[model samples]
Target: MSGSLRHGSGPRSLSEIARSGGPTGSGSFVYDEATLRSLISKWVALADHYDGSMRRINLGAVEPPGLDFASEALSKSANTSGTAYLKYLEQNYRYCVEQAQLLQDTLDDYLGVEHQNVTELNKTDQPTGSQSGI
Candidate 1:
């Protein structure tokens, strides 16, 4: 049989390669415990900056320092091939932190929209009986 006619022994398509969960591909990149810890720490710090009382008083001053520290640590640790993994971890960690912030912002916007809708509904001069019926 021709090579292309093979059942499972032939090379995979791009989509198959992309979707595969084996080694020698993106699947090989696993998030280690240290990376998870760094990600969680960054996310908590970001949430604190956005919602903590001290952050509110300071107007978001705390987040930059934490981000800067993370950047510096990543740069310092990215020297050897073993430590080179830190660079990827750092990038992923920052991306996760940013995603968390975006999610929080989206939720806040949704809540504001809902609150406004409720306020508008309440402010209408409709009959209490009709409104209560709904």
Candidate 2:
């Protein structure tokens, strides 16, 4: 296989071995479709994990404050911590949304369905499944 493809040998596809930086003086590289798909899938999974973690942290439940004195005592800390957590969660959520959109776009491009309609249509002239001559 090494004799077949090598870097700087000639033009190759995006998913082709271009170079290999090994100690044998002959480096190896991979530009294959499987590698690209795996990379994209990993990125999507990472984004999902980050989003899930953020949600779990932000949605943690704590008991409500009681009397005025007790409320005041905990309010300051809760407010500060909650604010920080909320901000972090918001940032992660936005990042996740962006990643998801990007992934969707990639899939659409791959499947050639970016602008295709995905709805059912009713035709008065057409017979129903049971009414068909078949």
Candidate 3:
């Protein structure tokens, strides 16, 4: 069971790895609270950056530079490609934010379980009246 993802004979690309939730071979993921929090922060930051970039890319503000048929065709193609690229960026941003939210939720659940376990243990640790070490 190789942890690394492969495409045919070659390793998977970064985008693939990202889409697949990283290179966890066995599908078992483990992370500390700090690591999870950090990952959430980074993902949020990336999403914010992408959100900013999407705002800055105002395709409607600029018109095609030429009026000829050939130029029009070229401009149309360029706009189409640009729109697609923008969509890709938007998807990436959404993915990042979603990943961040997942991590945060997982962290919260983990902490809740941990606290419950601790509370249970603490209850057991307290000596009952019948078991008082008099």
Query: Which candidate comes out best when scored by TM-score?
Result: 3
After best superposition, candidate 3 residue 66: deviation in angstroms?
A: 3.0
- What value of lDDT does candidate 2 attain over all alpha carbons? 0.46
* lDDT (C-alpha, whole model) for all candidates: 0.39, 0.46, 0.60
Name the TM-score of candidate 2: 0.40
Clashes of each: 0, 6, 0
Model 3's number of clashes is 0
- The candidate, 2 or 3, that scores higher on TM-score is 3
Worst 10 residues of 1 by lDDT: 55-64
List TM-score per model, in order: 0.26, 0.40, 0.59
- Judging by lDDT against the true structure, name the best candidate: 3
Q: Which sections of candidate 2 miss by over 4 Å?
A: 1-36, 58-73, 115-134
Clashes of 1: 0
Q: Model 3: what TM-score? A: 0.59
> For model 3, what is the error of residue 107's alpha carbon versus the real structure, in angstroms, after optimal superposition?
0.6
